[model samples]
Every structure is written in structure tokens, then in C-alpha cells.
Target chain A: MMGLHKKDLNLLLIVMVLALFAPFILNPFPTDSALAQFNAGYPDLMQRFVIFGIFAVGFNILFGLTGYLSFGHAAFLGIGSYSCVWMFKLLSYNVVPGILLSVVMAGIFSVAIGFISLRRSGIYFSILTLAFAQMSFAIAYSVLSNPAFNLTNGETGLQVYASDPQWLQSASAPNAPHLFGLPMRATETLTVGGWDFQFNVGYYMCAIIMILAFYLSIRIFRSPFGLMLRAVKSNQQRMIYTGLNTKPYTLAAFIISGMYAGLAGGLLSAMDPLAGAERMQWTASGEVVLMTILGGAGTLIGPVLGAGFIKYFENIFSKINDNILHQWFSALPDGLEDFLITIVHPFIGKGWHLTLGLMFMMVVIFLPGGLVEGGQRIGAMFKRKPKDTNGGLSAPATPAE
Target chain B: MGILEVKNVNKRFGGLQALGDVNLDIQENTVHAIIGPNGAGKSTLLNCLIGKLEPDTGSVTFDGQPVLGLKPHQINQLGISRVFQTPEIFSDLSVLENVLIPCFAKRDGSFRMNAIGTVGNETDVMSTAEKMLDDVNMLDKKDVLSGALSRGDKRRLEMAMCLVQEPKLLLLDEPTAGMARADTNNTIELLKEIKASRDITMVIIEHDMHVVFSLAQRITVLAQGRPLVEDTPEKIKGHPKVKEAYLGETAA
Candidate 1:
């Protein structure tokens, strides 16, 4: 285990290889089948997996490493999306401008929020972020409402037209310009025997950016700054007494996380060509928090795994209905079929959230380390010898214990 | 000139007066110990000097500059470091990583936004951190999680962290407060070794008279919120006021 954690160089290599080949493994299901909803190989969903993965990864830098939980990260994401759309309207439809603006705007916003929020730590910090998020949501809904649509288009959201100028138009020459000139064309199609794969070019773009974000995050996690962050998390008073300033380090982390959220938001608008104030809602921010917690807080791969897990289950579970349940029950015995349907009905359709809530609760209660620990436990069980099984590998070795 | 001078510092918290007209001057390259009973405001005074708390009155100066209202890091940049009574350390970080933080702060000042450079590649910072860890005899446990260390080792790591900054003045609150008898002796020896090698001035707040006598060149005793006496360690040990304030009827 020491060797495994000591050399994180191999960890990124493994993740990169897996991400590169994920499309092939994920594309195995039939397009019309229920399993297809679980297929993250599709361009739209794949883009989401990577982009949201970036968002959660950034958030983990602040929440996971430093133990400072912010509930308003989605506001940064919304700022990114809106800025991207605005770029699409004023300048080129290229994603570069949008991404740049998103980062700048999010950084500015975070500085203001961090200055105030950082005055209080722990639960107060969390509350401050939540309050800020809610305030932004309300302002986006009211001031940017339709009657005076100066900022956002209110509930209608901001949309880009195909007639937008092509600054970096070469990227989208054959294809129509996406928000800020990002090419939305389906660029590649692979055929293997009787199977065909249609790849959206935008997904690859998102993937490349995600890889860059991952690299930067890895560097930050290993830096002296990262050590100070962990120090602040463990004991702020000790850090101060050590003659070190923790405020600036934490504020930097907060801003960096905000920029990641902005980038994710920019990508979202680029893919869909629309930005809504609803994206900045506290609930949306809470979703990423859930993703980070459910996956594993501090580990690198944990956030991505958590993002994919929540997105996949959300896509698959919400689509199921009473009719779908009845069809499955029809294959069973008459009496048992009705009973199974009754028991499973609430967990499908609109009740999908109930299932997710229960899963979140169970994970938090039983596996506080999240899915990362869950995977480790399974690996330990298989590797344990019969005689050593009673002591289980998960049990920490220590003098005090 | 004295490295640190506190002139008539007074601190009040609601109805309580933590420090009442406290005054002290610490010369360069000497150990000054503050011995007091509980609630004598030693910790409060330390906090005030380090900028964790601001005294209602009086001023603090370090290296001939006033340091009354500066932030802790600002005071640190002016060459003062502190070690808390509790063994405060980054539990999740490796022992070496904890030490490297102060080295980075001292080298780069308060902030350096070099997001791309790997922390391990900073050879100077790493070497300095390693040297400090070696000084504290924690070089062997460099890769271990700091939280896993024994109490004595944790205190040693914190000292190494402070030392890496090369501060002119060091403030230690209860350096041997919770240590075993053997650990307490080890700490005193470590302090002596540090003093022999550097021109560092120290202010130690301790309860153990043996540790105090072994390390302090000068000792100041406090009762209530005021300083009762200040003298050489030998005289302090024999002072009737100090004995009466601390040893009670048993010493008589």
C-alpha cells in the first residue's frame, strides 16, 4: 500500500490509458437497449463525464484536501456558461475566448466571495457559500428576467445564433460555429466489421481539456502549497504558530476551484449552445458536492469515478417507468410479479431521487471514504488468505490502535 | 539591542484581564523561560506577541521594529517563530512535507504562485528541510505520516518546522508539557543543542522546574496577570516568592 501511494506517477498513467480506451469498452451495448443509457461512450454523455469530472476534481482541491466545503461552486459554473454564451454573441464562436472569459470571471467572483467567506471557517464557510449561491440564483431569475433582459435572458436563458462571426472559424469550417466558434461537428466515424461508431469532435475537445486540468491538479496536489492546504485542514492554529500564513493558500485554492467550475460551465454551453441561470442554483452546486463525497473526497480518480457513477445512474434510473417495471414483472410468476413491481415502483421514474438519496445515505454511513474505499475493500477481500482473513487488510496498522 | 521587547502589554477578555501591564525584554542569543500557574496569561501573552491576539494596550517589537498589530506571517517574516503547547502538525502530510512548508514560506515569502513547478524539485527547500529534520533526529521517519509519530516525535517535528524558517526569536509554550520523564529530558537536551549551534533567542513557558533549570539562562515567574520576579535560573529556583506562589506550603 505504501508503494502504491508513494509513486502516483503510475496512477495518472493508468487513468490516462483507461480514459483513452473507455469508449471502446463502453460502446459494447446495443443502442436501443436499457444498458445504452449506461453507455458513457456517447459523445454528449462522454463530454459531460469529463467536464463534470473536471469540476468535481477542482472542488476536491478545496473541499477534500482542505476540508473547506463550499456549496456555491455551481455559481462559478454558471458564470462560465454565461460568459461563453456572451462570447458567442459578441466575438467568435470559438471556445478559447469562452474558456478564457469563464476562468477570469470565475476568479474575480471567487476572490470577492472568498474574502468574505474565509472570514469564518467550518460550518460558517459552508453556509456563506450556500447563501451566495442562492443570492446569485435569485438575481439571475429576477434582474436578468425577461422584462429587462440585460444580463441573462431569465428563465428563457441565453442562446447563440449560427450567424455569429467566425474568429477561429477554421475549426468549425465545415460544421456550424458552436458557442464562441467551437466546432460541434460529428468529426469521426469508426467501423469495425458490422459495428459502426460515430464520434462527436466536441467530445474529444472536452477530453483534451480535461486531461490538462487533471495534470494541473496533480501538480497542485504534490506541491508545497498543497502541503499547506492539508496543514490548514488538519489544524489552522498550528499552521499560524508555525509562522505560516494559511489564508492566502486557502483563497488561492478556492479561486482555482472556481475556475475549474467555470471551464466546466463553458463546455456545457458550448455543447448545448444555451446558458440558463438555473445552472447556478444551489442544488446544482450540491450535486457536485455529492459527486465528490460519493466517489471519494481526496483521491485523484475518485471524483471522476463518482461523476460517472452519478451521471450514469441518473440517466438510467430516471428513464424507467411503471410500464417498464410491468414488462419486467410479466416475465415472472403472476403473484410474485405484482409484488416485485410494487416494491420497485417507487425507486423508478420521478422516485429515482429517493433511490439516489438512500444510496448517498448508505455510502456516507457505511463507507465514509466513499467508493474508493469500497473498491479497496473488495480488492482486499480477494487478496486475503484464509488464515489472515479475520484481520482484514482494511484494518489500519498503528501503535495506538 | 534586545531581539524582542514587550512594553507594558495589557490584555482583557470581557470581564477577565488575561495580561496586566506585562513587560519583558529578551536579549539576542539567550533562553528566557516564563513559569506560571494556570491562567497566568502566559499563553495569552504569547498569542499577543505572535499576532494571534491583539493586546488592548502596550506594544511588541522584534529586531527594532514595532510588531503590535502585524499578522502572524508578517511577524514570521520579521524573524520570529512559535511552537504551540500541543503538538500541532499536519497529520496527513509526511514528516518531511510538514517541515518543508516553513522553508517554502521563508524562501518565497508569504505567497508564490508557481503552479507548474513540482514541489519536490526545489532542491534548496528540500535540503534545508532535511537538515532541520536531521537536527531533530527525525530524518529516519521522513516519509511517515506525521500523525503516526509519538508525542515526543511530533513536538520534535514541529520544532524542525520552526527551525527551517531560521527565525531570530523562537517562542515555545510548554515545550515539555505532556512528555514522559525521559521525553522531557530529551527535549531539554534538544533545546540545548539548538542553542549551542545557533544565535537563536528563545522564550519558553514551562511547568517543569527541572526542564526549566536545565534550559533557561533566565527565568520569570508570573502570579495572577503580573510578573512576580525575573532573575537568573539559580536565584529563581531559590526565590521565596516563586516557591510561595507555586510550591505552596510544601516547600516551606
Candidate 2:
């Protein structure tokens, strides 16, 4: 009663089922089949889904409920990665300390940023956060990379160094990052009939973390703190007048969201033990925004769904080459085959971003509430939802439901 | 002793004196109205009292606590709530949530991180908000978005949000500013009902003579950033200064 509503419990069950069976669901293409190239059961891509899901879920907490569009959340992500990597370099290959430190470090950083940026609202808040993030990027690029510090390692990227002291690590232990003796790189491949499902340890770890993150987000969404954030979004004018010091509530949400991004970043390093200044760029921050909006903001499941959808498009769409296109249209007549390839060329491989942009545009225009709203709209139509003309008052409406 | 004491309050905006030496003792549990013609510093004085604008040199004390340097929320925590000229309900939240915001603030103060605690199951908060909504006759439509509410309903929702806090002083700035006469009457009835049921003091800045005369026990007339007169509503209606400064040519 204090945590999940019945509906939210159902959502959690659905997500758990999906995540538990994704290896099978995503590997539908049989081994050695022509479509095998499209198989997303690989560990790398699955890990990305859960990781970015964490990122988007965190972003949604700030942007969705509070309507504070932070254009620099990726700075926290980059900082998380850097902190995690530093943990790996100085301590050992264990991910526990790295992940813990990442969240804590991101929390500290966000508190400072939130205290400063939350003084302004609307586009000004966005600009302030963006400027702080850009400054962080610059510091990571040059200042921190200098011989006096060299914290970020500049453009070369920071990674585990064999020469560095790993005091807690046993010489007998595997050099890669791991939980105790279980390496994140371990994979268990199952072959049934012609299909092959590969379940990787890293994916499961990320999946478990993502589920916890989602659960925390759902709790926050339904919490009193969350209601305050939504009130802040709805009308700061009313909020201030209602005796609510809105700044602290917003700052708390911002820091929590930043910690979410940090968790995502920590997981990134945990899975692949690397950190780069480019990870903190504004484009990365924009990606999380796109993921949240494209999936549907303010909904419990939207951010994760959005994260998976975008990652799926990025991975699958970017893998299709001209040769694959020719193969797809080979049976057609020469003129038609050539024409189709020409038309489809710009939207595949290097042009996958173009397809993504168009899809996002369509989503924004036709489905303002994003994919979750679309699902609800369909559900509402089928369920014959009652039209709310309460007391026969003609009221303006939107996806407020 | 007065619940609210405004002493030597002066506010200036650039070269224009918005309020000059404004002093008033707002008694407990009384519906007091401050009426004036346009540009008569009524709104400015209200702003100073609510901590929106600080007086150049003066003090505002609510329940004898200095409120001059306090933030808006801090002042609110001292039991002061204001309803704007236009309805200022949380437009994006559901009707129930608009009322719940203040309940949370009332219980938890201005800032809290009880992020994991559920709102609906807080039985205490839910029942309080529901009771307030019921009082405002909006219990049935609590799930509707506040933005979608009719003008009269929005006003009702705002009143519910304010009164739910059960502040010691309620500040209403032109509560019926944009309403039709029918809606204005409805608001008047609602305000009367609210006042009769609770021992709450109210400070209202108004332009409507009808509303002022109908509800106010005592009226203060402000003219050109100065208090023209303060007296019983009946006495103020016949006062020559009020007639000259406000009623103008209609000095009967």
C-alpha cells in the first residue's frame, strides 16, 4: 500500500518478464539465417538498453515531474564514469566501490549544480545547467588532463592501468572488472533448434540494477516529494504562495535524477571499464531527453520503454548496409531495386540518425505524450473509457490522464 | 493585540510612492476589506504584508512575529495564505493534488525528501484533502485536471487549497476580479460560508463596492498611497473623504 499501486505492480511484473526473457525475445532470428545480423541478443547491446534506461528514468524524474529541462545531465554521467574508473585504477577491479562512489560523487556534484541552476527556472535553468556541463566538459578536456591533475586523462580516455596500484586485487584474480570471481564478461549461450539465446552476466547485472532504479523511480513518482515536484511544474506561482519553498524540493529531485545518471555511467564503466570526456557532451544529455519524451514523460514505464526503443533503433538501423539493402530488394526488377535502394539509402547505416530524427518528429507532432500515451490511447479506445463531462462543464483537456 | 500589525510600512517603485506610512491592525477572525480606486496602493500594501515586496522602512508582524525579512513560504508557515486575483491552482495537477500540495507543506514544512512515502496511503493527508474538497463542493471532480476546471470551479479549488491550510490570516486579492455577476455572487456565498464555519481572519484587497459592503465588518480606504480613512463599513459609505477620493462626483 505504501509503495506500488496495483497498476504499478502489474507494470513492474511486465518489465521483469520482458527483461528476464529479452535474450529469447530478441534472438528470434535463427542462427546462420540471413536475418541473424539483426539479432540483438548480444551482451553489449542488451547492457546498453538497461544502462540508458536508468539514465532516461533519472532524467524523467526531473524533466517530467518538475518540468525542469536540464540540458546537461550527461555531465553527471561522465563524472560517474570517471569516478568509477578511478576506483578501478586506484583500488581493484571490483565494481562495488566504483558503483557506490559513482552515485555519491554524482550526488555531490549535482547538489552544487542544482543549488546554482535552480535559482532560475524555464529556459534560463536549462541554460545554466548547460553552461555548467560545458564547463565540466572543458575541465575534463584540458584542465583536469594537465600534468598537475590528469584526472580525466584528456582525449585519450581513462581506463584500468595494469601498472597502477590495485591494492585489494589478488594476483590470482582476473584482471577485468568483476563481482568477486564472477567476471561481467562471462556469457552462457543456449542453442535450441535453430535459434541461439546468449545470456551474459553483464546484461543480468545491469538488468537487476535497472529494475531497482525503476522501482525507486516509481516510488518517487507516487511519493509526496514527487507531488511537490509536479506542483512546481504545474505552477511555481501557486507553489510559492501555498507556503512551499519550491527550491529545495526541486533541488532534491535534480540531485536524485543526477544520481540516476551517475548510476547509468557507473554501470557503463562496470560493463566496459572505460570513461571519456565525450560521454559528458550535450548530445548525450539530449539523447536522454529524446528517450524520455519519445517514450513518454511522467509515466513510470515510459522512460525505460523509450530507452530500449531508441537503443534498438540505433543498433539495428545502423547495422543495415547497402549490401544488405540490395539483398532485401534483390528479387525485384532492376529499375525498382535500384530506385528502392536509392530512396532507402539515406535512412540506413550512417543515415540511421536521419530515420531516428524523422521518427522523433512524428512522435512529437502526432503523439505529444509519446509512446506510453499512444498505448493508453489505444487501450482507452478498446476499453470505451467514459467521457468526463463532469457536471456538464466544458473543460479543455489533454493527456492529463 | 492585533493578529497582524503593519507599522510605518512605506514602499516606493522608482520615483512613484506605491505606499506611504501604511499602518493597520488586522483583528483576529474578522473579514476586513481594503477598498480603493485604481492606482491607490491597495495592491502594493497587500504585497508588502505578504512579503512579496519589502517596505523601504517599516515592519510587518503576524501574531507579533516580524515577517518583513521572512521568505514567502516562511511567512506562510507563520499561518498566512494568499489567493491571487486570478486562480493560481496547480494547473497541471489533478484537482485533488492541487489541494494535497499545501497539506504536505503544512505537515512537513517547506522542504522534505520523503520520496519513498506514498501520497494516497497517507490516510491522514488523503482524508484532510478530501474533506477540504468536500467543503468546496469539488469532492466529486477531484481527479479532473485543475487546468480543465471552469472559472468558478477553479476559484472554488483555490479557496479549498488556501482554507485547507487553515491559516490564521487569509489574503484575497480581487477574488472576484474577472467573474460574471452571477459567478461573483456564488463566490460571495462561498466566502460567507467559509467565514461562518471557521474562526479565520481575512484581509481582502478589493475594488467591488458591492462585495466590500456585503462582507466587510470594517473597511480601510487607501487613496494616493495613503490611508484615506478606516472605519465601520456603514460609516465609510457616508464619509466625505471616501466620497471625494473614491466615489468622486457621487458624494451624496
Candidate 3:
């Protein structure tokens, strides 16, 4: 079981099965049906789900384990994306070198940022990270994209120009980002009945990488280092008094999560060879925080769940406009149809954030441990029924529901 | 030479002289007690020894090496472990994990990545932690969250955490500060059993004469941040200076 405990192994297997069959699972609605717009089987959105899943999984290492809330993790992601695009521009369209370079570059920056930011814990640490991320966004937007040194390519974003020297690219090789001869954009469409399922090379790659990242996260959660990180969160005073240094432990978690974000950013560019200054924005960092918290910050599967939840809403919910709303409520009476659309309009389309906000609030209030806790509670409820059935059979005097 | 030596230790917090020219020696394999009333600077002295506070003037050495200016973790690595008046276990973690952390710290020095392998696979550390928990009679509750444990159990778990490291010096700050009689006796018995089984030095700071007299071999009475007397517990019980400072009664 790859050195995993039985419980963790089962969890990993479940994730793997779900990821491998996502195209089918996500596209339950037929293409010709009105609900087809809700199907998230497309390559672009599917790739984002796993990529952000990787980012949140990594963020959980630092924020969840060590209880250090970082508000600047997106800086590393931007650095990763930029490094990836630079590779595509100089080294070839092959994603291997770009992804590897992105991880390394993110690790370096994380070390520098983590070393400074980790000096202060709690809100101070968060503010410091926020400051660093904002600075990076500003620099990437204007400073680095200047004519003299266009590292990030400024507001227009960094992309591979045809005129740029791609030293390792061969004439026969795919012009787009690829692994060997397989282009990332390559996809096979499978039509069964009215459903259209997309099996994209890029999505599969991201999924495989996400699975690996998840496995690594599971290992870290069960490792001595992960225990130490949890100890850092629970009682840093106790940790220090017990002869454990908190500095290197927190810094290591920070660097590790940074590398994960970097890999995610690299994947983002690999899917579409563009690195934008907005990739490093504070809002991007905030989104990962939301994903981790919404999924269950400390749990192994929580971040992935949170990532999928947010990404699904962002993609599907936002795609529903007045036309779609009108189409869905067309069966109702004319007055009621317009009324229903009016009520739903504020929660969809450009107002998708309103829906996400309401859900996030509900999750925070009712399920403090996030979706994982909600699932566990439901599971416990089902388990309680069997035991209660035996007791209920014998207890004739007791009131039965 | 004693295992720990404090010479002319003076610590000032702003205008207040918290510890004024304090000096003492703690020998190996013996329980030493520091007894004083409130504001007698017992906690401050313990903080100084453990590197939580810097003394303005003094040389505190453990095993002939100066511990001044070292961080708490560094001092801990030098074989000194402190048990707080309130147990400081990792509350969010399991009881077993609470004990296992100290074992890792003892083996891995200050920091090691140790990220690839599973904690369950560290059979040696796992066994050591289990044995320590067994020593504290908490083996069955290993899976229980440390936060959910009763206060007495929390203290025992904290003891196990410190003892798993097998430090040269174990400092207890009011080990039975607010315990009921039954819990206090249990702690006393636990400490007695630990003392009988291990070759370790203990320094206890307490206001409770019952716990102090039950465990301490040597007693040092402090008054107004100065060491008034150091003697065997039997003699310390009869010392007139101890009667005056500790008993709150004027002794002629």
C-alpha cells in the first residue's frame, strides 16, 4: 500500500478512482439537455480543479498543521508560472523542464519569505505574508515586465512568442506544450447516448500529478515531521521546552507548501502557456485559503474537496446568465418564471461570489471542520441507526419514533 | 561537583529585583526542593535555569557547561526538562503522540526533515513512547486526545513526555499545585516510583509542605529572592529560619 496505513490507503484509492473517472462522473447530464451547462467535464475546468487541489493540499501543510496562516502563497505560484513560461520561451515547449524549474524557483523564494515571515506567528505572520504577496504582484505587474527586463511580461502576461528562440524544440515535435510527442491540448471525445465525455491529455497529467501530491500529503500527515508540525500548532511553548526547534520545522512546512503551489502554477501554464501578474495577486492567495478552510484545513482530503467545491461553483454557477435562467424557468407560468429568475439572479452569473460567500459562511458556522466533518457526521448518523435498531427491539417500554 | 550550580544569580525586571544574588548547588540523583511563600522568586529562578529569563549577573552551569543565553530548546537538548504547574502537553494530539514528540526530539536533536517515513514505521520510537506511556499507566488511553484527558492524566502524560527523553535534570514547578488529596497522593506515589526506578535528578518548587516533605531529600528555603538555608529535609523541617519565612510565625 505504498507505505500507507490501511485507512490512508483506502482514502488514496478512492481519490484515484474518482480522479481517473472524473470525465464520466462530472458529465452525468446529456449534452442536449438544459442541465448540460452544469457538467464540468471539459478539459479546462477539470485541469483547474486538480491544479487548485494541489495548491490547497500544500497550503494545508503550513496553515493547517503549524497553524500559520499565509496570505502570500500566490507569489510562489506566480513565480512558478513565470518560470514555466520562460522555459517554454527558451528551452522548448516540453513541460518537464519548466515544471522542474518552477518547483526549484518556488522553493528558493519560499525559503527567503518563510524565513522572514515565520519569525512572527498569528496575525502578524499573515500580514507579513500579505505584504510580501502584494509587493510581488506590483513588481510582476510593472517592474519586471519593463522593456529592459521583461521577466513577467507585465500586465499582458508572459507567453511564448513564435519569434523567440526555442533551442530544444524539434521540427517534428508538437508546437504546443507537451510531454514527449503528446500535446497537452490533445483530447479524445467519447459519446455515449447524448453525453459527451472529454478525455484530455492535459487533464490526465494534472490529475496524475494531483494524486501524487495528495499521496505525498498523506505521508507527511502520518510522518514524524507532520506530528512535529502539529505539535508546533498545538503548543509551541511545549515543543520548545521539549527540545524541538520550531523555526526549521515551520520553515520546512512553508517551503514544502510553496513548492506544491509552484508545481500547480507550472501545471496551469503547461495547460495554457501564459503567466499573468494576476496569478500572484492577493485574491489568488485568498482563494486557496478559502479552499483549504472550506474543505477542512487539517484533513488530508479536505483541501481537495474544498478546491473542487469552489472551482465548480466558479465555473458552472458563473456560466449561468439571464438566458440560461430564463430557459430553466420557462416551464413555469410567465409571471412566476420572471419572479424565479429575479430571485436567482443575484446568486449566479457575475454574482457567483454571493453564493460562494453564503456557502462559506454556512460551512464555517455549521461545519467548523468543513465538508469532511459534515460527511463524518452523516456517516455517524447512519452507523448509529444499526446499533439503535437492536436496542429498540428489546426496549418495548421505551417510546419508538 | 554538583550537577547544577547557580552562583550569584541576580535578575531585575525594570525596577523590581526578581532574583537577588541567589546561589545554590544541586547534586545528582537526589530530589532538591525549593520552598517559599508567594513572591519569593521560585518561578523566576526556575525560568533562569531553563533559559526563559536572562539573569543580569550570574553563572548557571549544568554538568559543568554554562546554560546562560541558550534557547529553551537548546537547553532542553543539554538534558534538562521542565514540567509546568499546569501540564503543557500537545492538547490537540493523541496521548501517544504527546509522548512520541519528546522521543523524536531526543533522538533527532533540534531539527530533521524525517518527512518521508511513516511515524508508525518508526518502531523503535513507537515502542519507546509506548513504554513511557505504560510507565505512566496511560497505555490504554494512547489513542485518546490529550485534551480530553482528566487533569491528573494530563500531568501523568506530561511526565511521560519529559521522562521519555530521559533528561539529566527534571524540574517540576508546583507539580501538585491544585490537586485534590487523592490526586496529590497519586502524583506523590508516581514521583516516588519514578525516583526509585530511575537515576535522575529532580528540582521541585512548591508551596505545599506535604508534597515537598514526601519527595525532597534536600530542601532549600528562600525568602525575598535569597536562599535562606540549604539542608537535609529532616533538618529543614526543624530549622528556625524556615519556621519564620515559611510558617508565617515569628520564631525566637
Candidate 4:
């Protein structure tokens, strides 16, 4: 019975189309253009954008609607990644088992964490989650480090071998694994424009699962369960007196978000075919939080954009160096070039995070709603008269429809 | 059996006895009012009944089942709903969405994990919420943000929210607390109308005598965490103890 608003649906369609064609849009810079330093259209980064987008989207489900700030969501991501790698090592190289294992592991971990953490709310809840995540990280770094060294190859990480069983295909076979016995690889790719997109077989697999995750999140956002979550955020005491159980609702949101994180973790290892304990680090969890906040916490599309934004910056900025900055500024007058180089120097080479941190602070202080809000503002400015009375810059009221 | 029964319920907060040896029985399909001065443990009693505060002793039964120790949502599932003194509807949600939430709870029980179904597409929830809002004369303001509504309209929306749940026993903690006189009268009239149309039991805590006298068939007066008297509205108006504790000696 729940459907997106027509405007929201249109916006979602636009985002989907854009994500699909991001490679082309990002490839606009000439082979040696200065902007090429910022290009993130490559397959590796694009894949990361989607995976982390899943992470942020999941975080938003709990933080945005429920207003519960969790500082330990990275634990679930790390668990997912670890479980996924274990699946690949023990079961098969096929990603399906790995992703499923990740989701299950993350979900079980969340249940235990949520049960204990949900006993407190507000700052306490945040601290509780942080403690749990830190504990997990420490354990993973110590006890699991040895097994992971053997299993995941420790910090060295695990990689698939070419001689490893292609569970999806047998050697000397013309076709990939069949369902039971039927050919499964036939429907893999649908290429266009002479760009050999394999569907990668794996890429399409992740895409289908991402779509499912997106759809599930959308449903939860509109369902009565989501209503209870918002109610819990608004006035928990009132909910209790109104005869509503706030605890279970909060727990459900926590678990759901954890599962999504796990899914993202699984997908990451699947694509890269390795899992390191670093994936479970607190900073990785913080990155998703940043992405969610940067994209707009409550809105569906915000987290995706936030994920893309952060990943894009990471990919592009990491590639730029002092030489690249110098080459661009060399065209200017001597003094101007020196000033320009000074201005841009810190943001290039090893200082990429400095730029990103500054941008994040600006966004938080000025536009807490993230890039989605920024986009909406730009769209509104173009559509309305300059002196429009509505003052469209204010946060869009959540449509009660 | 009474619709709701609380017997010998005792609650203590550290050393302070918030409620001690409290007892009350609310009849079916009647408005029952509890009136007391500030710090008389009126809110504590409400909290104990709804399981927000566990009573150190005694039991609460709704319809024939023990409601003590049950979660709030579990109590709601037993056909009990409450509206807080301050308007508690989701502020960001529209008036309609606020009412629709309780309606969903009534139909779907306490918890639902279905994350794919469209909420607004539920025809029955919309129609029922619409009807409830109409009963409270708030159908016109259904689409407005509940937080933006005037105090009176907000009260109306809260009432509508409770009504949509089809609660057998409605516990309202001062439904007309901060409204202007005109709005107060309107709310009184709305309560009277709802009482007439539905066979719903009510336990209301009120500071305002006019709203209480108009709606409550029975009145319970509390003083210092104990029930001073429980009597018919007429007797309560004349009772010497109630007059001394609440209504004032001159009124008696």
C-alpha cells in the first residue's frame, strides 16, 4: 500500500540512471586533463561507491529515522567481511555463499549487541555501541588475527588462486555452472556500446542484491515499524504510556542496519576476494556514519550520494600528487603560480584527507542534510523566483502522506 | 468483572513511596475520572497501571488478564490505549499519519517486520483513521503537520489517535490541560460525542472540574498517594472528604 511520492520516485529514477552511467559521466576528462586527477569512473572505485553506499544506507535506517547514533556499526561490517572470506575459503569461491554468510553473521552479532546496547538510549547508547565495536576490533585484531592469518592470511589478506575451483564452472567446460546442472552463466552479461561489461557475473550479482537491500530499506522506512521507530525518537516515554514497546522496535532497526552492513562487507570481499581485519576497524564504521550524515541521514538517496561522494574523493584525491598540482599551476604567473601551488598543495599528495575533513565540517555546520539537501536547494533555486516567499532553503518537511 | 482492575499496587522510587496500597476498578463503557492535587501520585498511579513503573506489590488486570509487568505495547494489544497530558503525536508526521499509526498497531499487533509493503495503501487504516478524525472534527486538518496544529487541534488529533486503535479502555492524562476555555469546551463536547457513539471505557486524570463533571460517570479522588474516596459524580461533588481534599469546603 505504501508507494513513494511521485517527485521522490522521479528523483530515485534519476539517481539510478546516473549511477548506471557514472563511468561515462566521470570519464569526461581527457586522458591528461587536470580534472583527470579527480576522475572516479573506474570500475574499482565505482564498485566501492556502491558497496559503501549500502553501508551508509543501512546506518541511516537506524540513525536517521530512529535518531539513535550508533558508533560501533563497523563491527558488523568487519564481521561480515570476515565471515565472507571464511565462506570463500571453506565452501567455494562463488560469492553467493560468501554474501549469505556475511548477512547471517552480522545479523547474529547485531542481535547480541542490540540486546545489550538497547538497554540505554541517547549518549549512553552511543557509548555502549562504541565499546562493543572497540571490543570486537580488539578481539578480531588479537584472537582472530592468528586464525585470520591462517584463514584470511591475517593482515596480509586472502586472495583467490586461478587454480582454485570455479564452483560456478568446471575446467574444460564451455559453459559456467548450471542451476543444479543447467547453464547459469548464459544470462550473465548484456553488453552495450562495445564496453565489455561482464555483468562481470559478480557485478550483476552484487547489483541484484543491492537492489533487494534498497527495496527492503524503502519498505521499512514507510512501514508501521518505521512509525514506531520515529515515535521512539520523538518521545520514548509517551510511547511506553501509549502501550507501545519501544525496545523491540529499536532492536529490529539495529539488526536490520547490521544486516545491510554485513551485506556490503560481503560484497566488498567478493569483488576483491580478500578480507582483512582492517575492514572491521572503527574508522571504517566512522566512514559510513560520515557518509550517512553527509548525504542526509533520513532521506533514502542521501546515504548513497554520501557514500559516492566520500569514495569518489578518496579515489580521486589519493591519486593526485605535488607534481600534478605543480603542472596545473605552472601555466600561471610566477607569484600567482606559487600562491596557487601553496593553496592546492595540502589537498594533494598525502593531504587528501585534510580536504575531505574540511568539506565534512563545512557540510555539517552549514548543511546538515548533506548533498541531497544541497541538490534540492539548487533545484529549488532554479525553479523558483529569486524572492520566493517560501524560503525553500529550510529543511523539507517530511511529507506525512 | 470490571474492565480494568488495580488492586493493592505499591510502587517506591528509592526511599519515596510514589504509590502505596492503591486500588481501583473501572467499569465497562463508562468514563471514570481520577482527580488529585499535584504530587498526590496521580501520574505514578497511571504509570503503574500501564507498566511504565513496576509496582513493588499488587496486580493490574485488563479485561480479565493480568496487565502488570506487561510491556506497553502488549497492553495496547489487549485493547488498552493511552494519551499523555502533553500532545504526543509524531510532530513531523501529518495528523492523518499520527492516527494511522495506532490503527496499524490495532490491526497488525505489537511488532511487524514487513519492510516492503506500502503503508498508505492500506485502505482500511485510512478509512478508519478518517472516521476517527471526523468524530473529533479534525478531518479538515488531517494533512497538516501535527506539531504545527494549535493546542486544541493537537488535542483533537491525539484523541483521534487513541480512538482509531479501538481501545476498550482509554487512559487520558488531562486531555484538555492547556487549551483555552473555548477549546476546552470543544474537547469536552468531543469526548461526550465519542462516549455516546462507542462502548469504550475511560480512565481520565484531570485538573479541570468542568470537563470531569461533564464526562465522568464515576470519580476517584486521591490525596498523598492514596485514594481518599471513590463515588458517583453527584456524591463526589458533595462528599466532605473530597471537598476538603480537592473540591474545597465552600463548594461542599
Q: List all candidate RMSDs to the true structure.
A: 4.1, 1.8, 4.3, 4.3
lDDT of 1: 0.81
Residue by residue across A1-401, what tens digits does model 1's lDDT show? 21123446566666676566557766876666655545557777777888888899899989977899999999999999998888877766666787789889988999999889998999999999999988988887777665545678788888866765645555544444353343675557687764446677787777777877877777777666776777788887767666667888899999999999989998888787789989999889999999999998987777877887888777778888888877767879978988998999999878888889999999999988889879878877899645643223222321100
State the lDDT of candidate 3 residue by residue for B1-252, as single tens digits. Answer: 899999999988898888888999999999999998889999999999999999999999999999999999999999999999999989888888899999999999989998998999999999999999988888877877788788999999999999999999999999999999999999999999999999999999998999999999999988889999999999998888888886676553
For all candidates in order, the CA lDDT equals 0.81, 0.90, 0.93, 0.77
lDDT of 3 by residue, A77-123 (tens): 99999999999999899999999999999999999999999999999
lDDT of 2: 0.90
Which lDDT tens digits does candidate 4 get at residues A65-85?
Answer: 899999999999888888876
Better of 3 and 4 by DockQ: 3
Identify the superior model by TM-score, candidate 1 or candidate 2. 2
Error of 4 at A13 (Å): 2.3
Off by over 4 Å in 2: A387-401, B247-252
Instruction: Report the lDDT tens digits of candidate 4 across residue range B1-252.
Output: 799999998888898887878999989988999998888899999988776778899999888999887877787788887888888877877777778777777777666665666667778888998888887787766766677777777777888888887789898899888878998898888888888888999999999999899899999999878899999999988888987876566765
**Model 4 DockQ class:** acceptable
Candidate 3 chain B TM?
0.98
* Highest-DockQ candidate: 2
Model 1: how far residue A378 lies from native, Å: 3.6
Using Cα atoms with residue i matched to residue i, what is each candidate's TM-score against the true structure?
0.91, 0.97, 0.96, 0.88
